[model samples]
Target chain A: MADTIDARIWRGGADGRFETFSVPRRASQTVLDVVTYIQRKLDPTLSYRFACRVGMCGSCAMTVNGKPRWTCRTHVARLEDGPLTVEPLRNLPRIKDLAADMAPFFDKWAKAGGRFVPSTDAEADFAIVEPASAERRAADAGIECIGCAVCYSACDLVSWNPDYLGPAALNRAWTLVNDVRDAGNADRLDAVAGDAGCHACHSQQSCREHCPKSLNPTASIAGLKRATLRAAWKGGP
Target chain B: MKLRARAETLLWGAQRASAAVLAVCVLAHLATILYAVRGGLTAAEILSRTRGSFALAFFYGLFVLAVAVHAPVGLRAILRETFGWRGVPLDLGTAAFAGFLVWFGWRAVAGLFA
Candidate 1:
């Protein structure tokens, strides 16, 4: 194995270009480790975002070799074919070197009704939801998303339409839609039903393909389509 | 805005429903053509089979309507995403395109039927 690996990392915003640095390679070293090494040893000025190095927080997601991935989990061995090129996630404004602004991403989430509206007040008893039920199963299928925005970055439609809700938000809405305890069904359907909502998705399955959790937002979007169609036709939502 | 949101969902549903119809219509049309052309029929022979046939007229008419519904909605999406066109003018243009499809398609069907 080569003693050192060439690391080409994005160093600025919008018009920013890639800058290459050489880092010592170690066994079982991850992409995040390489970046951290460069930031600590080679260039303290190099900027990036990461909290949990174990991939739980999902704060360390970046574009690895032109695809969105969790750099904390992406091993150096898997990307050894060429100089590992890392950049901030796509379809978002760059804040700085390797850091994309997440305001638009979270804004779309809010627009999609990603937040759950509680049906019961504090005095009310806990709602019993069966894990085996169809609705609960559907919700559970998409509930593991850690807000990584990998699916959002993978979505081509988001790049085309700025107003698009993207995959993560739609997936969040799907879980809420299927939740029996959620009181936001009608309004949530309305939120995700329109031109920039679930209807805008191209059903290309790019979100499903690139999700680190393997959650299928395309299926969730399809469910929203069906739900929204019923709501529109029957004059419910 | 609320009306447009409701209309968007309905439009999406209409496009999908029309697509299902189109799938069947396209397959049946293709099958008919392959069957008719297998032994090589002359122009007169083809016209004789199609002219004054209620079944062919009905099938082709429905096919034309489905295409009229399906194509322009797809075009609306394309235009909105590609050219950033929206609202009244874009909807009007897409409806006009649908009308053109209906006129052009029905005229051809009428030629064979009449």
Candidate 2:
């Protein structure tokens, strides 16, 4: 019996080759399983990053057959065709073979003021905000991002404009936009506006489509655009 | 930094502002046409009233201005994204195209009114 599983892994930095791996076939195997088998059993030196074996952690995202996906969630049997090409997530700096540097991706979040800068600190009591309220509801809807960089990897605008605050960051901004207690509204808008910010988003919705959480980062981006436009017009914080 | 982003930002602002102007112009033009056609006016008669009036000139001028500002910016972005053309060459080419739109659009409106 010939042990045969044709998998093409991106091998090297920016300038890399799609080195094929003959991963052994297995039942109920996943894309991560294939990558793991290649890294562990076949080639001990294959550089790839994965935290949790499950889909909760978004660390295992890779361009599987030209689409950004959480490899842990992607079953190998479903995509066990002839050629399986894996590349680092798109629209970001590639650090190694399959691992992309996520610093810039998270940096934009900080720049967009993704943090909930409360009016009061830990010494102060919890300010009561009804979950049923419109603002809280909006915030709650978009609060589940795992920072997997899937949306960041899937965006074309981020690819075109390197300085663009990718969808996840802007989406994070939108959540804070609705946070009534968050005091950095004006500052956030200032950070998110201009050529390299939320205004740069073309509303292509690749982020929404590729998001593992089924969250609409595009809608959140639209929300930010509308909020920023209104805030700008009104000169509001 | 790349000029494409700055150009795009300016274009987005232009698109929004021109869209506002276009909205009012479209409504006014439509209403004016409806009013004019109610009496079954001839083209020559329509020209006689519309011609040489500063208001008509202004309205048409604003209309042309909106088109001039709007079309080429959108076209440039669409072209760049679709064709993968970037950098200073594409930027200059797009800026020139926008200028051409403004010039030709004003000329057409000028002929219609002037």
Candidate 3:
């Protein structure tokens, strides 16, 4: 193992260039640690975002060696020996050196009806849903999404079609679609249909491939496709 | 918005349905070609077997219809995603392409049947 690792980090906004820094190699050091060292020790002006320094926050996701990953969880030892290149997540507006504008990502999430709507008021009796029901199980398959936008950055369709809701949002919608207690299926289905929605997905499976949580947004999008088709067959929702 | 969504979904359904049909039609067509060619049959010999054959006409007609339906819908998506083309113009263009495919394909099928 080399005593130092050469890292090329993106600097500035959309017009930024990668600036190289020699970061000290440490055992079990993650990619996030390299960025942190660059910010704290090398160049104080370098900007990035992270919280918890763990995989849970999902804020530390970036394009590492041309792949979107949670930097906090990506160990340098696991990567092949080469100069590390990190950049802001693709398909989103660049905010700074390593942070991307999350507004569009969240906007699409809202457009996909990621938020849950209640079937009954709080005063009403609690709705009982079977945990082992087919719908529940299907929803559980993709419910572990951390909203990291990693899947969004990894998606090719998102880059092609700006209006695409991408994987994470559609995955969230799928979970809501199967929520027996939720009453937003009609609007949610409408939101996730059409050219910019689940129909746009080419089933490339990039979302499923790059998701750090091992969630399958591609499966969720497939569910949305079926749901939308059924809804369309029955006429407008 | 709802109408557009419904239309897009219906197109998606058409694309998938046509693709499934094409899958079976293509495999059968390929297998038939391989079987027919094994005997070193000439073009005229192949035409003699196909001409006035109701089974060939029906199968080939279905194949043409599936291709007409499937290709245009996929092309529409490609035009939109790759070239940023959309709206009624794109829709009309792809629809016309489908019509052309149907016309051209059916003409060939008709020739085989005749």
Of the candidates shown, which would achieve the greatest TM-score relative to the real structure? 1
TM-score of every model versus the real structure: 0.97, 0.80, 0.96
| Candidate 1 C-alpha lDDT tens digits along A113-220 | 888899889899889999899999999999999888899899999899988899999999999999999888888898898679999888999999999888999999
lDDT of 3 by residue, B22-89 (tens): 99999999999899899698889989999999999999999999999999999999999999998999
Tell me the spans in candidate 2 whose CA falls farther than 4 Å from its real position: A1-4, B1-14, B20-49, B52-59, B68-111
lDDT of 1 at A114: 86
Each candidate's fnat, listed in order, reads: 0.60, 0.07, 0.68
Q: Any residue pairs clashing in model 2, and if so which? A: none
Q: Model 1 off-target regions past 4 Å?
A: none
TM-score of 2: 0.80
Choose 1 or 3, whichever is better by lDDT: 3
DockQ of 1: 0.62
Label model 2 with its docking quality class: incorrect
Ranking 2 against 3 by DockQ, winner: 3
lDDT of 2 by residue, A1-237 (tens): 235678899988899888998888788878899999898887888888999888887799999999999999888778746677899988777888899988999999998888888878889888889989998998887899989999998998877777778888988999998988888887887777755677767778889898989999988877777676666655565
C-alpha DockQ of every model: 0.62, 0.19, 0.64
DockQ-based CAPRI category assigned to the predicted complex of candidate 1: medium
